[model samples]
Target: MNRRLLALVAAAAVLWPAAPAQAGPATPKAPIPVDTYLRQALDGTGLPGLSAVVTHGDEVVHAAGYGHDSTGAPVTARTPMRVASVSKSFTAMAVMTLVDAGKVALDEPVAEQLPEFRMADPRAARVTVRQLLDQTSGLADGGVGIPAAEATGSPAEYVAALRSGHLAAEPGTAWAYCNANYEIAARLVEVAGGAGFGQYVRMHVFEPLGMTGSSVGGAAADGHISLFGAWVARPELRAFGARGGAGGVVTDADDMGRWLITQTGHGPQLVRPESLAAMHAPSKVRDYAMGWGPSDVDGSRLLVHAGNLFTYTAVEAIDPATGYGYAVMTNSAGLYDDTYEVLRGLVALTRGAEPPPAGGQRQLIELVLGLVALASVGLAVLGVLRPSRRRWRLIPPVLPALVFVSYPQWVSILMNGRTVTWAQVTYFAAPLTVTLAVAALSGLVVAAAHLRSIASAR
Candidate 1:
């Protein structure tokens, strides 16, 4: 599938709920069988494990887990899954905490706080704390080689690597979702808050919100899986270190309930109400606020964010106006919109509406795509073994290589003219990347064999 379609699928999963014209009276409706809905979603998506929590004001309306996790442990409300980019709001809140203390200014040039944040383009020097939070810093995905940094280093190293990278646009001119921007923001948290980034979040955001089951950097639960053609085990979590600011908070359904309650304007006041308001306010460049993006559900405003680290995918949505919010996490990653499905269903239930059946069409389409990829590989092998004299046949054998090699460039074009690295593509879409690589390699081998056969005949 093309990147645009993939993005739309992701977005639709999170924001496509059809809420009621007006929310029903504040009287709590009979509890929807959210546990049943989540179990059904897990079965339909073929996910090995899933966890979800729904909250209304300070009450946890529903919290449950379905299937089994990586280690064959029964997934539960206490199982800690990496929340992925949902961690962005935590980072934003951390920055806001600094803002609350008068240590950080939202619109001040980031370079004023961290002199080492320079990029190859001088314009990068003007990026503000607010721009970084809202993703308008022009850093772009792969600008600082985030995938590599995520794999082997700290957020500080990730920020340091960006010094050699160029900005994708003038600072504050456009919104380009970039983890590097958060990495910088996280480092600023360290400098301004006078604590390690993770330490700061734990002491302020996580603890203050009463999310006791959550932590900044901890081993992700074992048995995490990724879907290539089928479910396969993924590696255990590496030390996220400072990169936790971008996508590295781990929490369980029980704790997520508290986090959601806080977002819905309940729980402890971790940051001032005004700061929280600013964090959710849409930025000048896009519908994105600080770390959250705003969406409309019925007439109510829903703030949403989704996260994927290849092995795990998560999404959270909160309608602060209605005091309803939910978070979903899954063990496997692919095109499946299981998390969003649960979120939408729960949101519908909260509004006293019947939840729609979860759609498994994306999974089926991905399976078909995987089968086609395998067939291409077989065709390439057959062409090599049974060489044909028609030079036209060579075109078919060589085409897959060209397509796979250019996949990154095509994705960059699709993503609002922002550049992407092969590593980032592979990390985000492993199944597609692996299939293309196999097709490309097989095609190259076949094309070479065909050329040799033609030369010999000549």
Candidate 2:
């Protein structure tokens, strides 16, 4: 028994060196700092410009802008960029201030508060102020004019145009995302605050938060679209056009940092803590809160919002458990949007999980589309060289052309009942539109050749 014990002890001693500290499971290294991860994320991203901000409680953990604007200007944290629908959060906050001041009542009818407010629907009279911010006002984008071209270009005109439109559902009974809700809310702010929408917000919200550069209607930089993996700069269709209660609000990373600090229930008390809590609480009808949508992230509450213009895209998020806020904006939007992926990567860092690598699907999609366009041209050349004997063969190709011409009317079907303008289609749908145009033009060429040959034979 003594000899056996000695042999076992000797074997254990020999095996100890093989089982060093790393032998079992390696210790996880800390997540890279926000700034470092952000720089790394920009490495392979085929984007023109990117702006990001991360806030922790009352402090700004990181704020930066990467790449260049459309004018070839280097983007910095101070570079202004359109935050898109993220503006709703600011608009919500602005309204909240009025709510706290007893200037605007949350449950009060908006039409009662703003006498100028009128919609063709009698139900519009009952729409509450809270419904607009929560996006449960029964106002929907369906049947509304695409891009709102009919507006003479003001918030008043926007509301005036709605005079002919009706409601889709009862107030507070359902939830739907519609910009008109916020626009009317902004007009209400103008009336209640006794100042222009921009002026009231500037004095009440921006001034208190030290967000000196924020404004109501403005453009930060030129927008871009991807073409065959290459970025082509394009003008914003509504670059600071009309009243900006819906989508306007050009800002920068630094300003977003300040905004986040306030949004996470930090910074100065813009509104009472209870009012702030009210803003974050999801409504009974949906997970959408006042300005942010409440979603579950790793069993914790995440308040988030995403915005997309034809030429730009952005995302803003706040993690209540950690008091961490993140915002990411890009100058380009088309084929694919990288802003959300970037936001996810940033969110992953907060969880200590390795971030998904920065990636883009636009290049691949556009390349495949370019190849299809080339194929269409080649087929047209062959058809012209030896014209098709059957007219029915040519008829099928022309149909795609009709789809493009009448796209504004039918594109809504693909977008799930959301209206779209022909100009809007030219941006997000550029590659698809171009491909369809190529095939259609090719068909027309072949048809013309066939018709000429038949005439000569006659």
Q: Which candidate is the best by TM-score?
A: 2
lDDT of 2 at 43: 69
What digit string (tens of lDDT, one per residue) describes model 1 on residues 346-448?
Answer: 7787877767667565565556557867887788778778887668878977788898878878766655544456755654466667777888888888888
State each model's CA lDDT, in order: 0.76, 0.77
Q: Each model's TM-score, in the order given?
A: 0.86, 0.88
Model 2 segments more than 4 A misplaced: 1-30, 144-150, 239-243, 296-301, 449-458
The top-ranked prediction according to lDDT is 2
Q: Residue 352 deviation, candidate 2, in Å?
A: 1.4
Residue pairs with colliding backbones in model 1 are: 70-223
Cα lDDT of model 2 by residue, 361-387, tens digit: 455566667888899899889878987
Q: What is candidate 1's CA lDDT for residue 42?
A: 79
